[model samples]
Target: METKARLVAAAREPLWERGYAATSPRAVLDATGAGQGSMYHHFRGKEDLARAAVDLNTDEMRAQVDTDLGGPGPALDRLHRYLRRERDVLRGCRFGGLAQDPEAMASPVLAPRVEEMFRWPVGRLAPVVREAQAACELRPGLDADRLAVAIAAGVQGGYVLARATRDPTVFDSAVDGIVALLDTARTEP
Candidate 1:
């Protein structure tokens, strides 16, 4: 890839894995095998490069969510697809992991992106939930927005649980719990 693309790509893993506080610009440069001059030529500094990397990660994640939730199926099934979608459970979420990093959350550049990362998924999921409710697949009394937030939270929390326990099954169990809850919420046919 091009130098700028390479830098952003290389920065993403460290930023996700190490957080903004620990991921030095030099580490990114070393990973990309690019000189300091190339980094300077492409980005204003570490925060700027981090912003680009975060933006890329956000875009990729949003696209995947859109695909998973927008696919042809019942809204409930789509939601299940989203929850059970393949993920690197042990590695945790890129944006959710960054939110735990104080420096990342405090950065002007990173903060808004992180906030959007959380908000956007909820926004995307809410309508699908509402649709399920409309079709009588879910309880009519259910709060779509809150359920959407819970779904998003379950995935993020699952990642944390999995990472904390060093067991990917923890993540699966969390998802299964959410699935069971959803099934319980379904209207009796």
Candidate 2:
């Protein structure tokens, strides 16, 4: 890859795994075998590179979610697929994990992007939930927006739980638990 692309790609893993505070420009340069000059050429600084890396991560995640929720099926099934989709549970969520980083969340550039990472999913899921409610798959009178937020919360919370307990199953249980709660909302037997 080119020097700029290499810097961004290298920055992504460390940013996700180590967060903004821990990931330094030198670390990125070391990872990419690019010189300080090359990095400076491509980015204003660590913050600029971090912004690029975060945006890339967010875009990729959003597309995956859109695919998962947009798949062919009953709306609930689509939601389930998203919840159960393959994830690096032990590594935690790239977007949600950033929320735990004081440095990342404090960044004027990163703060809103991280917030959108959480907010966008809730927005994406709300319509599908409404679709399920309309089709009688989910019980009536439930608030679609709130339910969407809950689902988003469940997934993020699951990551924290699993990380805290040092057990991936804790994550599975959280997600499965959300699915079960949703099932209880089914209009059908």
Candidate 3:
């Protein structure tokens, strides 16, 4: 890999694993076997480099969501596929974990990236929820945007619950519970 790419690749796992506050410049440099000068040459500093890493991770996440949400099915099925997709539940979400970091959350420079990362799922799912409503798979009274936000919130909240309990099944149960509630909205006589 190119030096800049290598640096970013090295930094991503540590940032995800340790969160922004705990991930240090030296650890990132050590991961890439690059020196301080090399990192500085490519990035303004640790936070700048972290921004790039988070951006990279967000791109990957978008691709994964597209795979699940864009799959062939009724809109609800696609949304279910998204909610049921494999995840490292106890590891928590990288963006969510980063947002939890006081250092990242406190900074205007960093918080927006974390915020935007979360906004993607809600935005992407809104149309799918609307389609389901139009098909009467969802009740007509349901607000598409709010339902989309709820779905995204469930996934993120699942991670938090699983992490807190140190139990992956807690994540599964939360997801299954949300899906069950969505099922209740199905329009049928």
Candidate 4:
């Protein structure tokens, strides 16, 4: 890995563990074994470094979601595959965890990037939901966008509930519950 990439990887856990507010530039440097001058040359500062990290995380997330949402299936199946995809259930959502920090939430640069990560998944799922409704796979009253947001929130909520309980089962249950709701049977005459 390049020095910058190494720096980003080293920073990921600390930022996820300590959050942007508690995390320091020096911590990233120490974690990566990069000198201050080198780190600065690669990034403007901590905020710039954080933006890079968020971008990396977001891209990875988008790719994983695409794998689930872009695959062949009914809408409910696609959404189920997405919700039930293997996850570090105990660790929580990377971007969501960061956004919970007061400093990260306040950061103009970091906040938007973190928020965008969540928004991307919701947006991607909305189209799939609309298609499902068009195919009559979903109830007539289903709101595609709202349902997408709710699904996103359920995943976020799963992370929170899991982390709070320090167990993975809570997260799994949350995911299953969301999937079950999405899989609700359509009314057939």
Candidate 5:
């Protein structure tokens, strides 16, 4: 990997583990084995490095989700595929879990990228919902945009619940419940 990319990748694990407040520039540098001059050469400071890492995570997430969402299947099928896809259930969604940390939400530079990472998936899913409604697979009254938002929230919340309780079953239950709700809602009446 490139030096900058290495820095970002190294930074990602610490940030995910310790979050914004606890993850210091020195920690990231030490983790990456990059000195101050090397880091400064690539990024302005910790915030800049965090933003780059956040963007990298966002892009990776978007690609993974888009692939699932656009896969060969019905919208709900694709949704289920994405929902139940193998994940580091223990670590949780990297970006999603970080957003809940007090420091992450407070950092002006870091917070927006984190928020955008979430908002992108919901935005992309909304269109699939509308298409499902148009095809008469979903109720005409179903609110695609809002439902997308709720589903997105459920996903993040599922990870949070799973991590807090250290139980994968909780995450599975949340996904199953949401999928059931969406399936039922999408069925032809």
Candidate 6:
């Protein structure tokens, strides 16, 4: 059981680094330091094991966002915390990056997992945006749902910009630009 868990954890980094189509089962085995016999014993094959790793990866991503956004604080402050938290910028978002992959996008099996990864955050973010608006931290008449979508876009799009330019600052600048736009929406006393 522990060995299987270890295998999933090992597979996760490679999947995030290289996406589903590129990473090999042998690489996963090497990462976990487990033998082929053990891999087969633990999983049907690479796809089955990759599913486990992807599931774990997506769950972990959700928990982090839930904690940062759901934690008690001023609503906009929570948004700021989420956007400003240090990330492996050049590596990009594990979930968002997967969504862009040709193979992953084409696969019915993989595509929904990627969609859930985006949907969960945007759904969670809506309430936070509503809270910010209620607190007058955001301007009235703005649609919280749209704002939440924008926020998600900013983060995911930041990853795109960073990866394209091979510069982490591109990601940070995207985040900062979104933050500034939100700031402009702040109500004056």
What would the per-residue lDDT of candidate 1 be over residues 38-124, giving only the tens digit for each residue?
999999999999999998998899899999999999999999999999999988899877898999898888999999999999999
Provide the overall lDDT of each model, using Cα atoms, as 2-decimal numbers.
0.94, 0.91, 0.90, 0.86, 0.83, 0.87
lDDT of 2 by residue, 1-189 (tens): 899999999999888788889998888899889999998888889999999998889889989999999989999999999999989988899976678899989999999999988899999999999999999999989999999999999999999898888899999999999999999999976
Index of the highest-lDDT prediction = 1
1-189: candidate 6 lDDT, tens digit per residue: 588998988888878888888878888888778999998999988777877888888778888998899999999999999999889988989886677778777877778888888898989999999999999889887899989999999999999999999999999999999999999989887
Task: Order the candidate numbers by lDDT, best to worst.
Answer: 1, 2, 3, 6, 4, 5
* Residue 19 lDDT, candidate 3, scale 0-100: 89
C-alpha lDDT of residue 68 in model 4: 96
**TM-score per candidate:** 0.98, 0.97, 0.95, 0.94, 0.92, 0.94
- CA displacement after TM-score superposition, residue 147 of candidate 1 (Å): 0.7
Better candidate by TM-score, 2 or 4: 2
* Stretches of candidate 1 exceeding 4 Å from the true structure: none
Q: How many clashes in each candidate?
A: 0, 0, 0, 0, 0, 0
- Model 4, range 2-21, lDDT digits (tens) per residue? 99999888778878777897
Which pairs clash in model 2? none
Per-residue lDDT of candidate 5, residues 1-189 (tens digit):
777988999888877777777778887778778888999999988888888888888888888998988878777677788888887776888786567787788888888888888888999989888877777777879889999998888888888898899998888899999988987897656
Among all windows of 10 consecutive residues in model 2, the one with the lowest summed lDDT is 89-98
lDDT of 2 at 158: 92
* Tens-digit lDDT track of model 3 for 65-105: 99998889898899899999999999999888898899998
RMSD, one per candidate, in order = 0.7, 0.9, 1.2, 1.5, 1.7, 1.5
